[model samples]
Target: MAKSKVEYVCTECGDVSPKWAGQCAACKGWN
Candidate 1:
C-alpha cells in the first residue's frame, strides 16, 4: 500500500511546506 501526504503553505508568503505554521518564517505572517 501507498500513503498520501498533505502540504501546507502560507498565503502571505510563498513558503510551501509539509506542516502548518502560525507565522511564516520567511515572511512572518500570522497565517
Candidate 2:
C-alpha cells in the first residue's frame, strides 16, 4: 500500500507544502 502525506497551502502566495508550518516559505505569510 502507498502512504499518503499531508499537504499545506499558503493563501497569500499559493504555495504548496508537504508539512504544516507556522509561516509560508514563498510569501512569508502566516498560516
Candidate 3:
C-alpha cells in the first residue's frame, strides 16, 4: 500500500482542518 495524505472533517460543519481541536471551530462542538 502507498501512503496518502489523511484529513479530518467536522461532521456538524464541513470544516476540513489538519488536526482535531477541543471544540470544533466550525461546528463549535466538543468533537
Candidate 4:
C-alpha cells in the first residue's frame, strides 16, 4: 500500500506545512 502524505494548513495565513507546528511560520500565528 502507498503511504499517505500529511499536511497542515494555517487558518490565519493559509500557509501549507509538511508537519504540524504550534505556530505558523508565515504569519506567526498559532495553529
- Ranked by lDDT, the better of candidates 2 and 4 is 4
After superposition, candidate 2 runs with Cα above 4 Å error:
none
Q: In model 1, what lDDT does residue 30 have?
A: 77
**Roughly what TM-score does model 4 have, to 2 decimal places?**
0.85
Write down the lDDT of every candidate, Cα atoms only: 0.80, 0.90, 0.77, 0.94
> Model 4 off-target regions past 4 Å?
none
Tell me how candidate 1 scores on lDDT: 0.80
Residue 24 lDDT (model 4): 97
TM-score of each: 0.58, 0.71, 0.51, 0.85
Which residue pairs show backbone clashes in model 1?
none
Residues 1-31, model 2: lDDT tens digits: 8998889989888899998888999988998
For model 4, how big is the CA root-mean-square deviation?
A: 0.6
Per-residue alpha-carbon lDDT of candidate 3 for residues 1-31, written as tens digits (9 for 90 to 100): 9988777788777788787776778778666
RMSD of 2: 1.1
- Evaluate residue 22 in candidate 2 and report its C-alpha lDDT on the 0 to 100 scale: 85
Q: Candidate 3, overall lDDT?
A: 0.77
